[model samples]
Every structure is written in C-alpha cells, then in structure tokens.
Target: MAVGVSGDDLMVRVGPDATDEVLGRPGARIFDMTGRPIRGWVVVAGSAVTEDEALGEWIDEGHAFAASLPPK
Candidate 1:
C-alpha cells in the first residue's frame, strides 16, 4: 500500500490490495479495491505491472480504477 499528497486539493492513496488482480501470474494482477484486477483488456502480456502515483500517470490509473468500483 502507498499514500501521498496528489496536489493542493487531493491526496492519492494507492494500495496493492486496494484492487483485484484478474490477470498475470499468481499474486501478480491489476487491483481495484479488493486487491484484484479489473475485468477489462487493460492487463498487458507481462506479469509485471505498474500504476499511477500521487497526481502522476500511475496515480491517474489508480484513481480511474478506484472510481469505477462500487463503494465497499
């Protein structure tokens, strides 16, 4: 899990266990809120993956994914 200031108005929180991983190797998946990957074509071919970070690209990806999920 990771947390940091996104900007003057937002604080981004990224957690590996935040989302669900549907693809990739064991324990290597795209997360949502339950540390799992999404059901989409976003997962790449490799087992390694990366996401957004505090107002950056990675952060954007994480935010979008988070928003798509239902409140849990």
Candidate 2:
C-alpha cells in the first residue's frame, strides 16, 4: 500500500481489485473494484456499503482513514 498527499487531492494505491463499501457523506463518490466512480468523493472516509459486511481492502482503508482521524 502507498499513501501520498498533494494539495486537496489524496492518493492511495489500494490493490488490483477493490470491491468494498465506502462510508461517506451524501456528496461522496464511492469507487467500485474497477476504479469506477460509484459516487462523489465527498469526505475523507465513508463506508461504501453496510457495516459488518465483507468489504474490499480498498474501502476498508478508507474507513481506516476516517477512524484514524482526530475528529472534525
């Protein structure tokens, strides 16, 4: 995994395939496994899918990011 920060854009090299739920506000975009824009990229982290469900590693990383933060 790789993490890079530039301006207001964040980049994370997830994996070959990512099919997980991303949790975010209503304006967020959740990308599917094939890197397709499932939704708008709103906040830092948002579970793409429901909790407790098996999430793709990429989406998990996004959740982790939100969890790791120090709150708003």
Q: In candidate 2, residue 26 scores what lDDT?
A: 29
Q: Per-residue CA lDDT of candidate 2, range 1-72, in tens?
A: 233333443334333243233342322233343666533232333333234342244356655554555766
Please list the C-alpha lDDT of all candidates, in the order they appear: 0.37, 0.39
Report the C-alpha displacement of residue 27, candidate 2, in angstroms.
7.6
Off by over 4 Å in 1: 1-55
Judge candidate 2 at residue 54 and give its lDDT. 26
lDDT of 1 by residue, 1-72 (tens): 222332222223333443344233322233234566444323222222232332354346556656766787
The candidate that achieves the highest lDDT relative to the unseen native structure: 2
Runs of candidate 2 exceeding 4 Å displacement: 19-72
- Give lDDT: candidate 1, residue 64: 65
